[model samples]
Target: MLRFKELVLTMQEFFYFALRAFATLPKAKRYWRDVLDQAFICGVESIPIVLVSSISIGALMSMEVGNLLEEFGAKTMLGRSTSNAVLRELGPLLMGLMLSARYGARNGAELGAMQISEQIDALRAFGTDPIAKLVMPRLLAALIMFVPLIALSDFAGLQTGALVAQYYHKLDPGIFWNSIYPRLLPMDFVVSFLKAPVFAIIITLVSSFNGFSARGGTAGVGRSTIKGIVASSGLVLVANFYVSKLVFDIMH
Candidate 1:
């Protein structure tokens, strides 16, 4: 019962924190430079890991799915199968998890440190809205940047998958490309792109909230950072599934 109450209170506080962050969206102009900086950090710094994970997953999926399709004498469907997996599912899903670890961890650790050093308090004492100065910019940056990251991840994954299909599966590049383009649906694109902002929200808010709630000095910073990463990563996975399901249900 005590644990349940604490959970409820935590939820309440988080609701207020997120509300305040969103409420400060109008002040974004005042913090445009911070928004741009955060965008570079989360968007530009995030590309390599996103590419690495998506390319590896795409290659593996193509190889495995190609083999299985070969057994059924349906190997020509490799492009279509791999396309659905990569673009509609794995591509965005993997990007979200990667950003949750990389971007989310960075936000958590940096903000946690600021919280511990009383920098956030100092901002408050100066009559500045800390959420506007700190959290809002991160939120806006993630919101703007995650969409392109997802698009890049989808493109890289499909390209790698095509290469794998042609080389390892002994399939022709023309056939693979042909199969994918004709079968591609607007719904697939919808499902893929929509996950970006959803993931951005989960990662930014959860990490920043954990950071602001940090305590116990240096050790606490580490703890909060880890908690932010873990929580955001888990939420990313959950949001991935639900967003796909919801989109498919409503659109299909």
Candidate 2:
């Protein structure tokens, strides 16, 4: 169809634009301000959301694990199951999804808007590395912040869940903690924590690329923003499955 051809062409152009953005970074200290903005602003602002989501995740997973194990008279193993799952997969994936939906889309839209407004072009006129200035810092910040957030989420979620399962669910806290905590080997946390950085790369890179590549006017920017979020979020889910499996396989 003619429409399909146009779609393909659009994507092809987008890649070229991304490459241009990549070329924007210069070899200097000028980019640090942008990186700091990403780290302290974008990355820091995302924390409260991450914490709240993590707590909910912990409580919910506890219920699921507790209910399932309780039926098997393995209620004490609730902590183990919950901990392993969070440390290995859920934590990074959830945080990435949240970031993509919240921050990723926002970044894309901001850049896209700038592009439409000709601000990016203005910077290019002045010989700036938009990629280094804009994209790289976001990517760096994401890589920096995401891993810690994942670990925090996993630990907090599991603990919160365990507590809920203990009193609210009439479960034995001592048994649950003892049985489950021991199973969360270093590898479990390491595997999930590792994925966060990879996701960070994916998120900032994809989003910033999408934003900078946005063409036309307001509609194009809006489209790019939505697509970036949706595509990045989907990538996170798919990536989680493959990466988690690969890590566990290697660990085991």
Candidate 3:
């Protein structure tokens, strides 16, 4: 019962914070410098890992898919199999988990540290809107950055899959392209992109909520970071299921 109550309170905090952040977005241009800075942290700093991991995942998936399809002498299906798995599910899911660890934890820790240091209180005393000045920029940055990151991940995964198919599976590149293009509908791409923004919302809000709610000084910051990542990671999985279902219904 206590656990349920705590969960409810956390959800309330997330929604309340998210609403305020969104409402403040119009005036966000005034915070452009901060937004751009956060964008660099979330988007630019994340690219190297996102690119390497995505391509590696795609290649690994291709080998697994090729092995499965080869059983029935359907090696050409490698492209469709790999692309479908990557785009519809694995790519976004994996990327979200990674961002949850990287960006989500970092956001939580940064804010928690500020709270412990009394910087948030100092800002409040100075008549500054901490949510607007700090949280909102990071939230907006996450939303903007996630789309491009996911797009890059999608492309990298597909291209690496194609390479794996050509080299490891001995499938002709033309056949691979045919398999991918013909099998994947336009909505597949759209749905994948749509998932990114929803996930971005999840990561930023959950992290910020934990940051805002932190207590107990330095130890509290550490705890908040852990709890925030765990919560964000779980929410990402749950959100993915519902978003994918919604996308499937709409596309169909």
Tens-digit lDDT track of model 2 for 86-111: 77777777888999988898899999
Clashing residue pairs in candidate 2, if any? 24-129, 80-180
lDDT score of residue 82 within candidate 3: 87
lDDT of 1 by residue, 1-252 (tens): 999999999999999999999999999999999999999999999999999999999999999999999999999999999999999989999999999899999899999999999999999999999999999999999999999999999899989999999889889999999999988899999999999889999999999999999999999999999999999999988988999999999997
Candidate 2 stretches with Cα past 4 Å from truth are 1-28
Model 2 lDDT at residue 101: 88
In candidate 1, which residue pairs get closer than 3 Å at backbone N, Cα or C atoms, i.e. clash?
A: none
Q: What is the lDDT of residue 150 in candidate 1?
A: 91
Candidate 3 per-residue lDDT over residues 78-135, each given as its tens digit:
8888888899888898889999999999999999999989999999999999999988
- Residue 19's C-alpha lDDT in candidate 1? 96
Q: In model 1, what is the error at residue 43, expressed in angstroms?
A: 0.6
Q: What is the TM-score of each predicted model, taking all chains together?
A: 0.99, 0.89, 0.96
**Which scores greater on lDDT, model 1 or model 3?**
1
lDDT ranking, best first:
1, 3, 2
